[model samples]
Target: MDWKSFMEGSKDLSVFALALRAVILYIALIIATRMMGHRQVGILSGHNYLVAAGIVSLAAIRMLNPESSLTSGIVIVFVYAFVNVLLSYLDIKWPKAIDRKPTILMKGGMFLRENMLDCHVTLDNLLGQLRLKGAPNLSEIDSIVLEPYGKISVIKKPEALPLTRKQMNLPPKMVALPTILIYDGKIDEMNLHQMGLDHEWLITRLREKGIMNLKDVFLAMLEANGTVYVSV
Candidate 1:
């Protein structure tokens, strides 16, 4: 099967040289990303995603083509990053030019079909997002906004909203964020200490639930109400 030829490319550069190039390119990408500021990876806008994809494609080409000059690839990567930074600044100054406005797909339980079509969203797609958001029927939603980043934002109708404590004149209760004691059968000691708990206390709670070993538990969460939820 010519395994040796497949493992080592016909290129003149050694494996170590390729490895060194990859390390340098990785560091360059990290520095470029840091200069771009803190933007959530999951919520990158269309322009940001395109710029990132371009940088990746350039890096991949340089990695695959050993004859290609690394300096050229690095320069191109920096140029793309600089362009992204400039566009980001323009987006903040003139949002309308750099960013598309959110489209209102539905208003007052009525589908704005024109807006939906303009946003390239179909009825089935909108309905699927609505179902995911727990709004099965149009009557339950006051509006549906298609965000610029390609996410659906749903607003439930006032009449369909769940009752709050203010509606029933109930006293407000302090709610604390849940702390993860164990995840994937591994204990988070820092989280345990933050909650003023220790391994011995955790074992006692586990024993109360008839669980003797931590390895058997897949997840353990302590909620704001002092409720310990364990899953095996």
Candidate 2:
């Protein structure tokens, strides 16, 4: 047995060259993952998962095939990820055309058998999902919606609903939603503009909080209650 051939393993590629290929392909995969965005890290829908699998497979080719070009492998993976990004954008722009809509399996205490059959959901599937969601008795359920992402959303009947401030005759307090004005010391000009604010106004507000330099702020948040929270 040739010592060098045995040392290089099956591909006949040198250990250093193989390691280099692995590192380059790994970096390409990271770039493709980022191009696909953070949503890919979460519970992926069918198409999203397919794209992610395809990317990994493409990257693997570069590692296994000694003759394959690293640049070509990177390009193929990037193109696949870009297609997913494009489809996601189109899905947002034309949801009905690009993606499936949520289907109502149960409504008004009645199970829609036809709808369930069309979605290929069996009685056990519905019951299991309801159990997982901690739903009350089937009779107390007002609606069971199958979301496009394959998750079930349950709505309970008004009688079975939990008590809230409105039911107790208590006045509702204002809720302030926080919006980021600056992230990582960079001002979100679009958000600032949407809030009807300008650079001068933001600078003045920051000054009031004893923050003289924008770069010193790691985050700046604006609440609906007219409060500005800054973090250094």
Candidate 3:
């Protein structure tokens, strides 16, 4: 269709009218996210992102089908609301694991170049972030961390020696694994059955926290410390 035709509005919305709808939807999203009381900054999951993609996609479809109802728009809003809830709940329950906490990127000025490469951070970026935290010299900084929240932190060194894993003959590398006890607000039955894990054990644990059903939880994971954390 021509641009002019699209720009025109009838009782059925044209492109210009749809553009107005888009604007209003965006405003509403901002309000919804703010009300949800989670950090609006940092890397968000694709499912959790609160953009107008669904509305934008449905815009043309609605334009073509004048009889289209507001049901699709409402469904999109619900989708975002659900995702936003899941993210917020997960972050709150596992603040250390889910949210960005500073991981030691550099210690004792020895240069943990390997870790920097793994986390996809650069030396220059690390230096800039450290400078913001008043780290004037590499010698003065005890540790530099690339936080998961896309921020860097610098800690000034005290009069202490650095610990070397090689010097101590520890493992060369660490691999952190996430426990998959819960998915989509439901307990993974197959995982529990194969692992010989007990649902009753989990239920008792949750009861101590006043949580009742597995379905009420959005995410759950077991830490290396042998604790099961659940989020709703």
Candidate 4:
């Protein structure tokens, strides 16, 4: 039998069963996506979006597979992981092949029609994005970049703006990497390593505060300037 017949022949659920499957699939997708990290959802970069699409696509396939049982769903998660690894390897080996670099529609106040056409962007759509940024008149814009994810980012001319940074009084710059020390009562060892501290350091500090277990700490961070903050 063909794939369709095969699917129908196997896991052929009643209408109620299909409804139950749909509900379960929805919840599973949400949890799976959350575990996958922030890059899995929201506005994704080209590289990330491709992977996200593949993951969701496979998950959908398995969810809809008539042959797919509860076990099949579990297997599909593995399939998603395998596909990610394989694609990642291919992307690293020949970065150019799978990566479609976005074209610049506008730069230095000059419009590049050829590039815009290649990106499948038109003037009206370009102006809409610009107008959203309160630049109804495109002449007030300095540059517009058509990012790979089909986002139109516009930077208005510096002179066009009325406020100066000095007047705003922004800070010098403080960079902090907020690491999750405990997620669902578990310590993130990789993040701790990236922060140049051993598990001993984390435990030592927390112990000083009368917290003996990593599970007691909800979040932690090491600022670029060498300061550790913990949250329970």
- Top model number, TM-score: 1
What ranking of all candidate models by lDDT puts the best one first?
Answer: 2, 1, 4, 3
Mind giving the per-residue lDDT tens digits that candidate 2 earns over 53-84? Answer: 88777777778777666767777888889888
Instruction: Please count the clashing residue pairs in each candidate, in the order shown.
Output: 0, 0, 0, 0
What's the lDDT of the predicted structure labeled candidate 2? Answer: 0.84
RMSD of each: 5.5, 7.4, 14.6, 8.7
TM-score on alpha carbons, each prediction: 0.74, 0.64, 0.47, 0.53
Report every candidate's CA lDDT: 0.83, 0.84, 0.64, 0.67
Instruction: Order candidates by TM-score, high to low.
Output: 1, 2, 4, 3
Between candidates 3 and 4, the TM-score winner: 4
| Candidate 4 residue runs with Cα over 4 Å from true position | 1-16, 47-70, 85-98, 165-232
Write one digit per residue (lDDT tens) for candidate 1, span 1-232: 3334323333677777777777877888888887777652556777888988999898898788766767777787888889888888888899889988788988888889899878889888878988898888887888899988888999988888889998989999768998899998899999999889989999999999999978999999999989899999
Better of 1 and 2 by TM-score: 1
Model 3, range 8-106, lDDT digits (tens) per residue? 324545556566555645565666556545454345433334433554455556545534544455466556666666776887798666555656788
57-93, model 4: which lDDT tens digit per residue? 7667755665666455655655664555555566558
Q: For model 1, where is the 10-residue window of minimal lDDT?
A: 1-10
Residue pairs in steric clash, candidate 2? none
Question: Residue 128 deviation, candidate 2, in Å?
Answer: 2.0
lDDT of 2 at 87: 85
Model 1, position 225, has a per-residue lDDT of 86
On lDDT, who's better, 2 or 4?
2
lDDT of 2 at 125: 77
